[model samples]
Target chain A: MSEKLKRFASNNKQLLIMIGVIAVVFIILSLTVPSFATIRNLTNLLQMIAPIAVMACGATYVLVIGGMDISNPSVMAASAVFGVYCMTTLGVNLVLGTIIIILTGAFLGLINGFAIAKLKMVPMVVTLSMMTIGTGLATILSGTRGLPRLPDSFSEFFNKTAVIIILLAVMLIMDFILTRTKFGRKLYYIGNNARTTKVSGIDSESIIMLTYVISGVCAGIAGVINTASIGTARANMGPQSQILDIISAAVIGGVSTSGGSGRVRDAVLGAFLVCGLTNVMNLLNVSDYYTTLIKGGIIIGAMGIASFRQQQAAKKGV
Target chain B: MKRILAIVLALVMVFALVACGQQAAPAGGSNQSTSQQGSAGSPKQDIAEAAPAEKPAETELKHVKMGLAMQSLQAAAFHAWADYLAYRLDYEAEQRGYEVELVTLNADNDVTKQATDIRDLIAQGCEVIFCPCLDSQAILSSVKEVHDAGLIYVSYCREVSHDAQGDEVPDLTVNFASEEQAYAGMVDLFNIMKEDGVEPVKLIDCYGDKTDENAHNREHGLRRAMEEFGYADLPVVEVECGHWEPDVCGQNLAPVLAANPDANCMYSSSDFLNSGIQKAMEDAGMWHKHGEEGHVYFSASDMYPLGIQHLREGYMDTAVDQGCYNFAVHAAAGAFDLLEGKEVEPVQLVLGTQATYKDIEEILATIPLWGNDYADY
Candidate 1:
């Protein structure tokens, strides 16, 4: 039993650490804050983390390819605005509005991937430019105007608890695709060594481009959820700061910055971890400054631990 | 990587510690603007305008479509303004004997998007456009385009310049002098402190987005008030919190808190800033403790849901509630006038500029803590 435990500990070190930290945080906060342990609060916490969690899922794909996708918030803002515009002004129904918006995000992400993979632009520069371009297009398409009042039926559909359930279902589907599909295999291979994968006859450009397209679709999904959650598609509803939060969740969940390693399961766990932390902070009335300080520390500490473990594993010839 | 992280953490900690040691004073010139101009101008009679049913003689009803380009509606207070204006216009358009179509454009805080939204609105057959701009130049370019198209374009709440033809071609009407709102906020804060009999009080004056003309005007108003209130001798340092972001406020004010143990009062340009200040103080446990009767005071303009609740709960002392409902009503009125070809001048509708204190119990009693409870998208 002891040998089995040791094996588990070494192999699942990052997961163990995340669970331990979360458990400790929960215990401390629950003891101190009356509202921390409530089911109602937990439910609300899940709702609040919904948008960021969805974005983090997409970001995990980008990071797996040894590239960063920091444009989700911009994509979300743009999607929400454009979605609402198509609904209200262009006289489209909600489903069509949603599809058009998602397609727009996919197209934007495809262009970004083409720039990065085909043109050999830095991922940072490419994604950053995409962020600006997407935001500009959203605002222009929205005509700087929000769908001030959504139809009552639309609002009702968005406000239902079923929305979150549906999103979780989407996450499950994404997880299956990442873990079980050929496309997923290609992603892992490319991230591990692009040159080797290319020599093996994998279309690296197509894989990279398709990943971005998927990232864009995920952002669109997040935007739709945001519209429902906030009950308005106000442009820039999720600002630049939200991007940092999404990245934090992805990293904290066990997605490596170096790429070729991570689990879709980790993204889910990371979302819970971040959402839980924010909930506890709110309950405890922690100042915004301290919250940010702690958040940054956690991200760095997680990366450090992961890197250190990797180094130790190499030294041990594991 | 660890060394880099450590250095960054240390720098942040140093900044935090240094901030706690400094004292905050009222912004420069807080007392000067209102005491000079507010007193200099004769008090306009508080006579109410004609009630909603009666149309003025020769009132023309032209079905006109108007557009307002917004930078973003993330700020709840501004969102309220947009929602209120749209709701009121829709509610009252029939009563005013006109068909009106109101369009709002969210620029997502992008300057280029703001310019493009303006052009799109113009293309949508909007005769006049009201803009709370993201970028002054971007909005101005749209103004030039709309003017060149011979559309009656005007900037409201935020000001924009006229073309070479001035107000002739575009037929623009600029309203809501932002400077007045700032002056009013500062004067109210000063009077609140005076009424509390708090003297020699140190304060942190938080301002927002210095690049924004409205925010700058608010800062200027507070500076004007300091000179008039004899609080000019107090030490005041300025920090700009970006467009009412709570996190930015916390970042800037955290340093200020570590430096100034004697900070009993804080003045913010926007209610959004007040919420941040409250969060900072609460975190530091400065709230409801210490400094001459043990209450840290805060005041700001544009009372939002949180701000209104804070004021009611004794966390905040005074503020200027930019009558959003009135803003909507007046915008409708202005739009009607423009449609009717009524000669409209440069008019600033300064609504709900009254200073509220705990003593004015009746007035406080009437102030709705939360209105329009249903979320307006």
Candidate 2:
């Protein structure tokens, strides 16, 4: 049993280091900030982190397959505005609105996938253009104004325990797929070398496209959750800052931006750390200007440590 | 799969075109109706006959094309203000036996876009232009070009400065005195705090977007009030920048409350920021009425509907209405004055109204509340 434990620890050394960093930050915050240790504060932190964490989970998949999606926030805004429009303007049921939101997101993702995977366009440019298109469409669809408040039932459903349970279930399923499925294995291979994976009859393009679809679906879910929480859906609901926050959380949690090396659990851990740091700073009454500086420093520091780890591993021929 | 993708893309394009066509159809119909009226009775002739003795003979009120370049319609307040302004312009024009063609362009909070919008309005032969500029400095050159084209430029809500010192101003300026409104609300809250026997009221100052001129002015106004109330040197527990975002406001405010649990009073830059602060306070069990222990006295600017509702619920102590309706009306009136070659007086108008819980009902009855007409939209 001791040998097995050692093997597991060695296999997840980077994750363990990340966990250590999170523990150190949490312990220090709890000690220094009197209100940080409260159950209420922790619950509030969790609630705030939910949408970003869910988005990061999908982003982790895209990153693992060597792709970048800068359009998640725009896609989220579009889905949210469309969803609210369906429920309020069209007087549709909650279930139908949700389906429409998810499908809208998937369609947006399909656009990115087709352009990047099939047409050989640069992922950055294609996603950036899609972001502009998505934002414009959201603005146009909402008639350049925020949608009216949604029904109480819709928001209540999102705030219930069921929503959190579903989010956890999604994370668990994604983790299982990455760890155990052939599809997941192919993602790593494609990230490592797409040409070799394609030569091996693994259909790399299809897998890459599927990853974007998953990302888009995740963005859709996040949009709904956020709009519900806010009680209104505006065209500019999710700003570009949200996308930056998600990417930073994923990277800090141990997800490789270069792709093919992260777990869903790692992304969650990152989200917790990021959210916890902000919560603690708020509890301590840190100025927002300083908060921004601290957040940037931490992200850069984490990225530095990650790069250092990669270099050491390369030198050791691992 | 590629063929299917192509077909889907084609369908999306077709749908977008149809949507655009539908939106334009109504405007086309309205234009047609206006032209028909013009041909039938010659509204310009009627306007010339009805003109006062001092009215310029050449200034016969015809179809005056006025343009307004708005910052963005994302915010409910801006949307409501723009809608009211358009309605007022149409009404005023009809009353004078003339037609008003108002073209409104949303800059979406982009300074460059605002400049481009103003240029386009000029090219479209807009006789007079009104802009609540996104950036005063960035839009100065565009304003210069409008002036060069012999078009009147009116500024509202924010002042457009030609120089760094703001020595050169627009043709007409409609000021809302946002800072004075914020200061007045704070002063009222302080008075309430004093009546409650609280000393040296601990304040949590939540300012709006730092980049905004109104935000800076409001912050200055708040400081002035603090000084007047002899709380200028009093230790402020926390100062947060909400950036006018509700979510950011709530997230940043929670920790401030956690750190300074005894903080009693808050001065918010706007009602929108107050909404987030109220939510955070509620979650922390700190939201209480005036007489309750641990009650948080709050004051804010912008008497939006949500703020009024909060006032009714005893959550918000006071709010200042920025007089958005009057501001828009005055802007349109100023443009009309310029077009008719009339002498415009009081180049700058500072309008605001203060509302407390005691007078919320009266305020609601008299004022047009933002988001009250969501169903109409």
Q: lDDT by residue for model 1 over B1-377, one digit each (tens)?
A: 53344334334433332232122111111211211111111111101122455763335754767677777777765565565555555444545666666656565564534554565565556776777665432244456567776676655556442222342233444445556666776677677667768764687878776445667677777777788887777787565575557778878888788788787777777776766777777777777622336686667777665666666666777777665545555665666667668876645454454445453345444443222221131
lDDT of 1 by residue, A1-318 (tens): 999999988777656666655565566546655555666455556666677787888888888878888888888778777887788787889779878768877877888789888988898888888888776776566442234434546646754376578568767877787778998878888888889999999999988988888888878877776665534465556567667778877776777676776766567667777655545443433333355565566556655655665566558975
True contacts kept of each: 0.01, 0.00
Q: What is the CA-based DockQ of model 1? A: 0.03
Error of 2 at B259 (Å): 1.2
Place model 1 in a CAPRI quality band. incorrect
Estimate the TM-score of every prediction.
0.51, 0.51
Instruction: Return the top candidate by lDDT.
Output: 2
Q: Which candidate tops DockQ?
A: 1
**Total backbone collisions, model 1:** 30
